[model samples]
Target: MKKTAKSLLALLALMLFSLSVSASAFAFNDIQKDPGKSYIEQLQKKGLVRGDGSGMFKPKSAITAQSAVTLIVNGFGLNIDNIRFIKEPKASDYFTKVKDNAPYAKAFIIAQLNGLDIPRDIDPNGKVTREQYAHWVYQAISKKGEYAWIEMYMTFKDEDKVTKGYMDSVQKLLIGKIASLDEKNRFRPKDAITRSEAAVILAKGITFVKNTKPVPQPEQPASPLTNVRMSSEAYGTEALKVTISAEAPHAGYGIEIANVAYKDKQAIITYRVVKPDPDRMYPQVITTVAAAVYISTAYTPVLGGEVQP
Candidate 1:
């Protein structure tokens, strides 16, 4: 009986150890099984996340500052090389110790430039709080909105109170209709947001921008000389000659001619005539034309020798 009890105790101890290991393991599906699974799946499809090697998303794990930077960088396809790091990010600024050549340093810098809520006392090693995660996500999506909404909503009086403004913004991003209100019809702003929740909000914001119609630029007037009229050659089989003339009161004007089919209205044809400075006495002879067929030509005038035309 003594031997049996000892064996039982040993088995119990082994089970406890196994449980502890499992808890520490970064299982990907932990987030996958969330009620907001569909939204999470959308984010995964967009290459925003990859579950653990075991095909599980560790949803509840506290995301680190580095991890958050990686996600925001990858999600928005930001350019890291051009990023300017804070003039002096002190050693204590990061929760995890930031090495000089850390791969995500540029990403972190970019996040800060774009107004991400990077903790001033950056605990590089510390877990990212749910509040911080939500704030960052809001900033990322709110960039397009010019941050007007984020600034207003972030000024809430209480972190836990689901203000009407907060609910409105959350509803703005339906996330496959998974973002429902609590009993008070308020979104718990201070609550730690799960990975699944983050994914849904991102997807909704992306969809909103995609669906919006882009503002159309006003069309400019077409050039006056749609077609050029050339007098027949004054001599034998010598090609027909044409001269274009223009004058700028203060400076010289550049004249260009091209075939009518040219896509860029302002693109000048090198083969066509180019007059640098036209004397007021003599009109600028843009080009001497020689073609078998009388094709229509387009002319453009650029002022002050600027390349903008």
Candidate 2:
């Protein structure tokens, strides 16, 4: 009897373990099989969605208005903190109903500005439908120049038959690369867009836009004045030393170089503004180099330089 009881207890433990394993497997599959997996994964990899405590993403679940705002913000690279909220919706305002303190307000504003915001009412507690998702995805693709004029007209108008005028416009814009007609040369516009279809369209749209964009030329090297260091040489003459520095790519940079003399100081030096380079590439090494020089100048002093209180 003792051995049998011990065996039963072991069997129960094994069953519990098996159940736990099965639950984990389900959770993992849930993320992979979600309809929004592509966007969710993209957002997750970009550090956007750190999913709630639940292991599952709950993809079929309704997205809150606030959550939608956050997704739009992170997905499209909008400034969330600095966006101003006005009581009335103006041409300049992004959202008509969103309050100043609303979460994801910046993203909502950007979406509105870019014409990507859905025309539907803002229902904070409502569930997003598959059709709505398609519309939003279509908006995103259109922003990237994926859909030709004809395709856009068809998609936006939800027409059963595309007119010749629309087709001609599409042909002009897309140059025959887009706007496919059926065997009867009829453009089917009323078809319901599927999730997989949307994914394929987005993939193609991003690729096409990127390939068609002009490649920017590398910027010219900075001159010797890129980095300037000043030191006190004498009571009347201050030596300004300059160094040229190159920076790596994708670095945040701001430059400010000024020479300020104290009110009672003997130095007559004044801050001279240098012409900013016209072809400055943002987030580049040159920007950092310029910023470093500016910072050094602010703290360094000439022989007669007076310290500010």
Candidate 3:
């Protein structure tokens, strides 16, 4: 009996191991020869995308607007987690065509809230053009954080065909090497972007954001404020608590640590004042407010970043 039980246990373990490997290594049968096969596979393996029901990825098919939005939103991990909604937001609130109960409706909402340039009356089922895809991908990358890019313009044979609003995104992608023009040196801006092409662009954008760091922006004139102060103290043994305090005209005005950049053994902190809600009322009285953050002991805290009005 013991010998029989051991054999059954070994068989079950082997089956589980095989299942795990198969799940991770899953690939679409039709994408083997596609130029973006590897990129598609990368996304599929990470659960950011999937093949059609029959194990085939129609690489040549034009991707719809909703699908494009869903992929970019998931691939870049965009979310509205930090946003406090007064009521449950729905797709109907922001878009005219997206159905509230549709599978991709939530993604559209997240994309819009994250600052993607989605039109209010966009047709979710309509095909997404290459220029549109490029713009959204670029905007999604921006939401991750600001990264330095070379200042240059890329000229293409069909530059005139590119929409004015999308020109900057195309140039930035080309400059970053996240995207490239065809052998004929033309970007078919109006062409409906294929699934394979979309996959490749998304994969490149994801990689770019993963390996890049936010660069500090050029200095700007500090906003005039009253009684601003900053200080740092030891937090436990390995961390430092950095704090910033400022006087506000009323309780409704507040301050927050907007960003932190670590460079040259210095933890540069940027802060912004939070504006009070327009619809809410607060006492009209002088107030002192503060915001704090903990950083590693290895770096010294320094006040940085332009204060926003």
Top of the candidates by TM-score: 3
Better of 2 and 3 by TM-score: 3
Q: Candidate 3, which segments miss by more than 4 Å at Cα? A: 1-25, 217-307
Ranking by lDDT: 3, 1, 2
lDDT of 2 by residue, 227-284 (tens): 3333332232434332223332334332233444332112223322234456764443
User: lDDT of each model, Cα atoms only?
Assistant: 0.49, 0.42, 0.86
Estimate, for each residue in 1-74, the C-alpha lDDT of model 1 and write its tens digit: 99999999999999999998875563344664576577666777677777767867766655566767668656
- lDDT of residue 259 for candidate 2: 49
Candidate 1 — number of clashing residue pairs? 18
Query: Clashing residue pairs in candidate 3, if any?
Result: none
Candidate closest to the true structure, highest lDDT: 3
Q: TM-score of every model?
A: 0.45, 0.37, 0.69
- Residue 92 CA displacement from its true place in model 1, Å: 9.5
TM-score of 2: 0.37
